[model samples]
Target: MNMPRPLIPQVMTTPPTAFPARIRGPLLKLCLGAGTLGLALHVFAADPAPVPPATTTPAATATAGAAATPAAPKAGAQFDWSKVPPVTAPSRPGMFVIAPSGPGYYSLWDVVTGNERKAPPVSPNAPYALMTNPAFEIDYRYMEKPGYEPDLFDPIKRIHMGEDFLLSFGGSFWYRYMRESDARLTNTSDNYHLIRSRFHADFWYQDKVRIFAEFLDARSFGQALAPAATDVNRTDMLNLFADIKLANIKDGPAYLRVGRQELLYGSQRLISTLDWVNTRRTFQGVKAFWRTPTFDLDAFWVRPMITERNQFDNWDTKQEFFGLWGTYKPMKGHLVDMYFLSLDDNRHRALGRNGILGDSITHTLGGRLAGDYNQFLYELEGMYQFGQYSNQDISAFAVASGAGYHFKGAPMNPQAWLRYDFASGDNNANDGRRNTFNQLFPFGNYYLGWIDRVGRQNIHDFNAQINLHPQPWATFTAQYHRFYLANKQDFLYNAAGAATLRDATGQAGSYVGDEIDFRFNIHVDRHQDILVGYSKLFAGNFLKATAPGVSPDLFYVQYNMRF
Candidate 1:
């Protein structure tokens, strides 16, 4: 009913290159944002209904049913309750959890047959309970057991405001200490501290009407360089939305959700909440969904929110992002997802091969397949893009695939996986087509390497990792990555999808370098965790030839408590 586990995914972005700098021009037309907005019109078609009788409810929609699951309600089908999680904490009253939440990623098949998903357990660095449900949308109805025992905070989770209205509360806090050498491979070093906190209130009037709102605070200190754009949102609204169930699960369960919200869909390659960063990502818009026992479909139209360091966050009025994502679980162990996404950015003039161009409109169509056979698991996804970026025609694509095996009963519960990823890049600046793939908003750090380099645009990554759960409360992971340029003429992008290095003449050679990372996560308890990690990049020919001749290293220790 909720999400967690691994299925990583990417995009392209901004700055350092040896080529001559291009000057900006006047505004491009708003035709794209104005033109494609019709696609978003369907999202607001809602017929709000009166509060209905109370009944048992399931998880709300997240994104894709790759965003995985029925986007809204496969809520009817439950999970296998007999399997005990290897990691668990005794639930205390007033606290959020008393037992393990169950497998992070499990399908109806796994639930029906007591099968395992054959994937690594959840880790702090990449946490989400039901891949389809972010922490904010968790279904805590299970907490209401027969003769439920009350804890100091128990009353806060389910408060009776009236005869049928139920209001609940939840929040989380995290602190991190970090150090980096050659930050951004700029021949520099620094140390910093970060703190973030969140609080939210959820309201439900029967099973068909609801409202959810969350607050956020994020800050950083003692950094030598200018803080990244996402590092500082002192205080603001993170998620504020309302959900209306259009129909009951028995009648093809459906929902219409509106307002500001966070989105996560298939493997999260193209869309995600991006929780790894202090200021997580969100959007303001409308979403509608419908699903059955084995499938679900989601449609949405929203504007990406712009985070400001000193003021309240606001949606980017110049850009509009919309999409359709669908998922099908053919029996449990196997799940398939398909999606079509579009983005229009009219904030600034787009630099084209010939000169300045008009606004941008990008359209993408992609699909993903994932499942497990006994102890072996596998995933594959492919995407292609078309449309316009200023005066240039857009033609780009990306692919992600991986296979793994879990030694379930083995000591430490060891597991390993190998993966390959590629996204097209443009080789000719004078060409009429823009070939670089836009990662959209994604959790790129999970797949591209934690060092925050090597985006999904114009790049190739061959990587592998091993996970070991040697203790009930601890997890250890180690990964190695080899990166290369898909097209030397295109810029080298970083994890946040910004262009950090480039050799326009193609003299840099394609090899970007090698990175080895190690991390550890300790499950202090169900609601608390600690994470320690380090990464080092061995500069390859590309970095040595184009940017500073430096290899970067990063280290951090973080503590998180969620209730």
Candidate 2:
């Protein structure tokens, strides 16, 4: 007969790995905060119940005048404890022990098991030892032992209000070389650099409340070469917000946030922080977040923060923005996003098709579906706009779609993708309806092309891209794009929302031009990255008919680091 296997008892314990030497300083600070949290939990965690004594099988006894039958052998004989080797106790407390219990099973327990004494009844000022529970104990693996070394002021880590806080500082420097031939009137070129520095701090209160703030100083140098690239700003407050945990749900917790912050949604087609720009976008607002394992929802009401060339930036009180964004991930690698946004602007420039300048209100409804399955990936998005612009009726729409495939076993881990985009334009200037699509605030450079010469309004874009990872740290990309006017009568708008070319007579052809771009990225290390890129555009018939159709060329090299 086969002997029954004994089931081993398991204990929940922390892992044994320690933080690496290089990051020990930062990790220690994190641990200090965690240790404070552990202390707080100790004050609240319930006392563990008493451990029962080890159970033993009673020996068989013969009754008076009755012969005791030999105890029937256990159905599956247990190992004789006398014949088994004894386990040596751990040399230190809190160390784990794994002992063989029977065939194919093991028992895991702490060396101090059964020896721990029960705690006294609760008291207002209990001794530290009474409040110290192993479940709430701080793992020294994540931190240096207390009194192991002298204390030092770490900028990135601190303790305040009996709680743990963190403070950090970081910055980036960027340089670009830009040249354009026959840019409407003259050939122009410029070399400029941008310095962006920021300081951030986070304050937490027992995982229930958090306050965050960041200050930024972004400025441009050598901009005199091209006065048009004035994306500079003096020192200013970027983000200041308070996040409060509202309640716990089945999958996770909900949060309410208020104050000045950055708002970014899927793909950033309609709303974004636009971090690529020297002075990024931000908003003063109230936002609510509800997240679960399968879905997330965000709703907000805000006004855009206007970047004043002056030292202190201000909020645009006359303009209000509100939106609801939600994403659903029903399965791994698949995602769907839906959103509705409303913008109300009191500025005079936000006018209507009838040429009246007044307040404008626009509402946008859109959704995106994207997924990656096996080696194939796809994305699709569509948006429709309606409302009132001054006296005219507002109506417009846009669509973007992309598909790609990865060659799993191919050299270089190559992948290829194709994408197309379309945005509506005013069909007839005389019409009372405004049809030109508004891009709102977006990362236009990423969507239009590497050259970033066109806006996402009244345009048609077709693009193809090839990507290769030549090494674990290096990537190469080649892209081609064809541009066209969605409507012949509409103006050719640039990324800055300016008309680069227009044919009032509506005789200009639709074909704009074709562009080719090549780029390479190298992630030198965890803290450093390098990028190099070149792009060339071949002028088409419409460009030739409207002005000097000189082809444009661009090249740039960039390096970035963080600490």
Best by TM-score: 1
Q: Whose lDDT is greatest here?
A: 1
How much lDDT does each candidate structure score?
A: 0.66, 0.56
Residue-level lDDT tens digits of model 2 in 1-563:
22111111100121214322323343344345434533433332233222211110000010110111113322333322111111110010000001111121000111124322121111111111111111101111111122222212233332323223322233334444444444432355545666666555665554466676667677767643444433766777677777788876544456777777777676666776665566677877777776554555667667788786555666676776777776665565566777777777778676555566767777888988876578776788899998777777789999988887767666666777789989888767547788988888775665676566778899998988777756434557787889999987888887656667778677878888898988776644333456678888788777777766467777777655433
Question: Cα miss at 361, model 2 (Å)?
Answer: 1.1
- Candidate 1 wrong stretches, greater than 4 Å: 1-133, 147-152, 249-252
**How do the predictions measure up, each by TM-score?**
0.78, 0.70
Candidate 1, 67: how far from true, in Å?
Answer: 17
> 40-138, model 1: which lDDT tens digit per residue?
322322322222111100111211111211122123324321110011110000001111123332322234465543442322112322122355545
Give the root-mean-square deviation of each candidate in angstroms: 11.5, 22.8
Weakest ten-residue segment in model 1 by summed lDDT: 89-98
lDDT of 1: 0.66
As for model 1, its CA RMSD to the true structure in angstroms is 11.5
